[model samples]
Target: MLSVMVVAATLFSVTTVMDSVETSIEKGTARLGADIMVVPAEAEAQAKTALLAGEPSTFYMDRSIEDKVRKVKGVKAVASQVFLKTAQYKCCSVGNMLLIGFDPKHDFTIMPWLSKELTRPLGTDEIIMGRGLTAYNVGSKIKFYGKYFEVVGMLEETGMKFIDNSVFMPYAAMKKLAEESKHKKGVKAANLPIDKISTVLVQVEPEISPQRVAIFIEHDIPGVKAIVSEQVISSVRKQLFVLLRSILSISIILWIMALLLIGVVFSMIVNERQREIGLLRAMGAKKSNIFRLIMTEASILSIMGGIVGIVLGGAFLYAFKGFIRSSLNIPYLWPSAAEYAVLVAGCLLLSFLTGAVAALWPAIRSMRMEPYEAIRRGE
Candidate 1:
């Protein structure tokens, strides 16, 4: 039973975490609606951090890159965004939060879905906020770098921190805010350059491969890096799995030890039960019956232990979901119903097999014993 519990717990916990990470990546990239993200060569890490964790970041690239990328073969559209960070101010709802300024015309991704939340066209004084900024409502006002902007819309949750905690506005509004921020007393001036863009989201034609387009973009442009959206997700998944492998190794060792312990325990129990088995044998119980009884008992305990471990492991993950996301700085989403079912089935099966295998030798040995001699040995 203990052996089964350890195996079940390890499988459940690991599967839940991996599923959440995978779900988050799929949802995040889909909502982003871009095949490629182009940024300054040096800001690659910073861009990933902001995109994954919703951490406030400030980075810029030449605005002219937007035109350069549009000229790339198979490029369908290009939208530029400016990234900004705020200084600590009493009026700011969230300190040092990310603020994004995007071109409304060329944006095919984030704003289209978010626009549904707006009753009218977004005004220059209005902003769209990510769901993580829960303290504010649609009509609420937020001050950034001493410039106040009204929250006009709220984005649906994307699991990606960048989308959840960010604020979005038109490119013109950010420029206006930057202009006003220069005169604000005791505040860090917005480090936005009128001629600079932070990131360029690119959508390519259907016939072109995103990876191929990304390579071309990088080759045609210097001082910039074009990252494939899928590549970013895969890189993060690989890095995290490498770390998880060590934990999985520990779980594997525990499983082996549990199996050995269960075998030893059942062996002791079988030795002590020789007298009982011998009497049953003398009473005409078949060897098959004795073997079946032992296997059945082991199977019952294994199933029960597996269930308890799964429940406990799932509850632990649910209780600490936030802590896991924050500590890892990664997006997470719970497994779908179908996914949970498959995982549960797999864990239970493994547990059952482990217990049954451990008890096999003990049951076989019991069946081979002669009745009177077995009773004498038990004495």
Candidate 2:
């Protein structure tokens, strides 16, 4: 029983970590797919490759493309965004950061899905800081590029590498910031057009295939590249699936070894108690009574091990949730009661099967013991 408990705890911990990692990757991929990404024709290769490699990259495209993309067949809506590369500040400043500009009312990805967590909605002079934006939150005013904006919302931790380190604000504010920076350095608008956008997100009509639509946009829209949800998430999904399969394989091997070891141990115990069994049989202790004793012992061991395993697993998850979330780069939520219950039941069932299998050899051997000879040998 003690051995079973130790093995069960180890197996459960391994499985729990495996599940958390896979689930985190899956959620991250889903969140990354909120919209189809559009990039500049010239930087298409760079942008796509960067995204696939899980690195950050930006491209330049005309803001006017928004109107054109919005009208494309199968395109439901379009929003433009620009990302500024990180820069070192003269003094202590927000670390490696990204400045994203979007139209709040029109940007479905940020305004609809993410802003609900805020006390107030996003606006032109308001910004929504990502999880990585430090020393800023709702009601805080931040200045960038000489343009000031109030932090009206804050994003919950979504384990994406880029989002955790970026800040999101309105396109108007970003443009204003650019103008201010240019004026400070005496640069002219003619040299730098504020109408440039780094990328765009297009929402596809429900009836249209995203892949087909992406192809159409790529062909029809010159100087632009289109990528739908599948293109971005497929690679991540494959990586996660591979990891999950490997972990499950390990768990199965551990479980089998545990069952076999348990069987061997119990077999030895039954052999040592042969004379006791023989005496009981001679005294008319029914075969069923002998069977019950073996079964009860197995059940006790299995149940105790299974329960301890589950509790330890839960504690591990609770203790290192933040670390896991950061490492995997996905939103975190406490395991729902339903999920936890399923884990407990599944573990219990596996344990019970282990106990039952381990008891089989002992059961058969004890049933065949010769009463007189077994007792005489013991004497």
Candidate 3:
């Protein structure tokens, strides 16, 4: 009985740990920026896919469109951003580095996240890189497709799927690289002139509805797609929660099945020990005392198993934290107090239930044992 309790408790702890790890990774991405996104009509499919899948993606947007967007009601602030495609730099290996071209002086929403790392707002010739570009640490000179530039700053680790693998620089820096590479190698940047940004980040007044603003933009503006941060995050969150719930459900079902097996095993043990139980009864032990002994053993086993499982689950969560975040396209935050409370409580409750359930049949059988027959078996 004790062994059965231990096994059931261990499985419960495993389920809790998995749940916490999944939640953490999803929340990390939400912390990096606003909830909304704007993409070019032509590139919306690719952008949405990348954002959800944690893969590299690029899109084009006309830089001139910002002026028109700013005029819309409820626009608190707007920042234009472009992501350059991956191409060979003069001296570096090929990897897609996000070239963010925004109004450095005016674009403070995303800039604050990069400020402490950068010497100053990026200049035409200077650039700040994502943690993914750590190879070009501060003071390292880098040449992108033949245009020479020095890495002035490296972004803090956000644990985000996309941000972790990106690099940012002034739009002009990218334009210069495109032009120079074209002149020298007779090739054009995937997208030229770079006047259009891939997306626009918008901040709206609290009193204004982002949904309303998005609707207005789509209706009033042409050649663009507008979506509020709330809309994007809500959509993403919904999908993630669905997955989390499914996992929880499966874990719960697994635990219940394990508990049933435990009960069956304990009942069988009781049958094999029928004579031993009858001997105790013959020795003047009360039926209640016999039941208590069995219950005590089951309880002890459950508590011990639960503790071991909790420790092992914690280790597993720590080891695979990064993989979970990257593969799921989410950020990872350590388990919080509330989450830990739930995990511990669930484990304890499940463990106790398994032990009690397992003892039920054995307890009843012991109560019914006859001392006369038990004594004969002992002989």
Candidate 4:
């Protein structure tokens, strides 16, 4: 039973982890809804980290670059964003967070998720939070640098940590915050690069290929790199797949060993029960009845162990999910309730089969024993 529990838990954990990584990447990219991201030449890695892990990547270029990218062929629209980290400023009391300054008029990706009441233009002192910031409500005020901004709205969950962990406001609002930060008495100056932007999100013309447009952007614009959205997801997929495959291989080996141990353990139990089995046969119990009795006992034990294992495994995963994500610096989202139910059902079925199959030979031997001969072996 103990062996089965360990094996079951291990198998469940690996399968859940793999599924979560794949789902998160798919959902996260879909939420982005943009064809390409253009960033400073050396900040490509930083941009990926910001998207995947929600870690602030403090790099910027002049806001004028937005105009240049728009003029490039095949580019239909351009939106500029500025990134800042709470750790850089005097607002350390609010904890570390990502600040995103977006052009709401040009931002199709984020604007669509804004609450209905917030459809109007946002004020310079107002900000919209991501769904992941559940602790704060719409009326809550967050102090940035030395100024406080009211939370005017909260966006829906995107399954992407980058957007979830970020706070969004207009470009002018962020600029105003920066300008005001310098005047606060005795406060450490929190300067967001004035008149600068971080990354440019681009949407390509319908007839033009995203990859082709990305290439053209890089060629036309100096000191900037264009990243097709899929490439970022693909890179993470390759890295996670390799890691998950290795974990799954180890789990398969452990499960096989547990199966063999169950067989050996059940054989010893049948030997010890020969006296009782002989008496039952002497009383006219059918061989088939004895076989079923043994199998029924094994099945019960296996299922109980499986259930316990699942409970422990699930608790561990849920409790440490945040820590695991932070350490890995990867985007991770749990499967929906229905999908998770299926996984749990599959594990339970595997557990039952493992015990039933291992007990087969022992049950056959017990049923084959003659009443008189079996009684002698028992003595």
Better of 2 and 4 by TM-score: 4
Provide the lowest-lDDT 10-residue window in model 4: 86-95
Candidate 2, 42: how far from true, in Å? 5.6
Model 2, runs deviating above 4 Å: 1-14, 29-35, 41-56, 115-121, 132-135, 146-148, 184-193, 276-289, 307-341, 364-379
- By TM-score, the best candidate is 1
Q: What are the models' TM-scores?
A: 0.83, 0.78, 0.72, 0.82
Q: For each candidate, what is the lDDT?
A: 0.84, 0.67, 0.64, 0.84
Model 2 per-residue lDDT tens digits across residues 129-193:
76655677678877554446787777764445455456787777667666666665432221224
Give candidate 4 misplaced runs (Cα > 4 Å).
62-77, 86-96, 114-117, 131-135, 156-161, 180-195, 203-213, 274-291, 318-322, 334-336, 363-379
lDDT of each residue in 1-379, candidate 3, tens digit only: 3443344444543455455445533443443454346677777667665554546777776777777777788877777777776565443344455566656755744456663645455666676766655566777776656556777777665545466566677766677766667666634344544466778777766798878888777777787777665555557667766776676676667667766776777677777777788888878889898888777777677666666666665666677766765665644445677888787777766677777776777777766778777556545
- In model 1, which runs have C-alpha deviations exceeding 4 angstroms? 112-120, 137-140, 145-153, 179-191, 278-288, 311-323, 333-345, 367-379
lDDT of model 3 at residue 8? 44
Mind sharing the TM-score for model 3? 0.72
Model 4 per-residue lDDT tens digits across residues 289-313: 9999889888888888888888887
Rank list by TM-score? 1, 4, 2, 3
Residue 149 of model 2 has an lDDT of 75
Error of 3 at 260 (Å): 1.6
Give the TM-score comparing model 2 with the true structure, all chains together. Answer: 0.78
